[model samples]
Target: MTVLTIIADIRIKPDEVEPVLASYRNLIPQVLPEPGCLQYDLHQDNEDPAHLLFFENWESRELWLDHMKTDHLAAHQAATDDKIESLTIYEMTKL
Candidate 1:
């Protein structure tokens, strides 16, 4: 089976890191139990507390797409909307 890897980098506003991180922490457990989810780990950059990264592995691209449309994902976006400085997502396939 091909695993779909998603590397998401989230840069939070200088003073908003804590709240944003809290919201993301709340999101982790919800995502881990989703269908086709193999791994969904969150990490913070060593030198920058405001830099958060999500390293994810899903069974397929389609299942990941379903995850993107989940209510919890939407709630997370709403909670951290203006507090984020930049967001980047990379969708990859394990070779």
Candidate 2:
């Protein structure tokens, strides 16, 4: 099975960057323990502190899909709802 990679671009209200970061930080531990998750890391742009990016690698598309239903993911989304200005997720595979 082919591995899946995802890049998530997240923009938040400038004032809420810290809160959103906390939410993501809490989520990482949960995601890391899940099956098929190879890596899940978060990054912030030096120029734009409110802009966050997630670099993720998974064992398969199916496993990644399963992750979408996880409670931690849902909670993170809910907690950051008001703080989030925009979100874009790109799913990719090595060519």
Candidate 3:
């Protein structure tokens, strides 16, 4: 089975960083227990508090896609709406 790796790079508006972080705090726990979820860790950029990343591992792309459609994920997105400056998601496989 091919493990799927997801790197989500997010830039939050300077003043909205705290709110966005709070949303992630709620989202991560919901994600970790889901089927095929191997890891769903969040990271902050030391130099730039407004920049954040999610380094995730899943059993397969299909499971990850299902995760994307989950209610918790939608709530997070709604909560952070307009607070995100930019977002980038990279889906990959190990060599």
In TM-score terms, which candidate is top?
3
- Candidates 2 and 3 compared: the better one by TM-score is 3
User: Model 1 lDDT vs. the true structure?
Assistant: 0.95
Cα error, candidate 3, residue 46 (Å): 0.5
Instruction: Identify the runs in model 1 with alpha carbons over 4 angstroms from their true place.
Output: none
Off by over 4 Å in 2: none
> What tens-digit string does per-residue lDDT give for candidate 3 at 1-95?
89999999999999999999998998888999999999999999999999999899999999999999999999999989899999999998889
**lDDT over C-alpha atoms for residue 8 of model 1:** 95
- Candidate 2 lDDT at 19 equals 94
RMSD of each: 0.7, 0.8, 0.6
Q: Tell me the lDDT of candidate 3.
A: 0.94
User: Per-residue lDDT for 16-55 in model 2, tens only?
Assistant: 9999999988899999989999999999999999999999
What shift in Å separates residue 30 of candidate 2 from its native position after superposition? 0.7
Clash pairs detected, candidate 3: none
For each candidate, the alpha-carbon lDDT, in order, equals 0.95, 0.94, 0.94
What residue pairs clash in candidate 1, if any at all? none
Lowest lDDT 10-residue stretch of candidate 1? 20-29
Clash totals for all candidate models: 0, 0, 0
Q: Which of 1 and 2 is ahead in TM-score?
A: 1
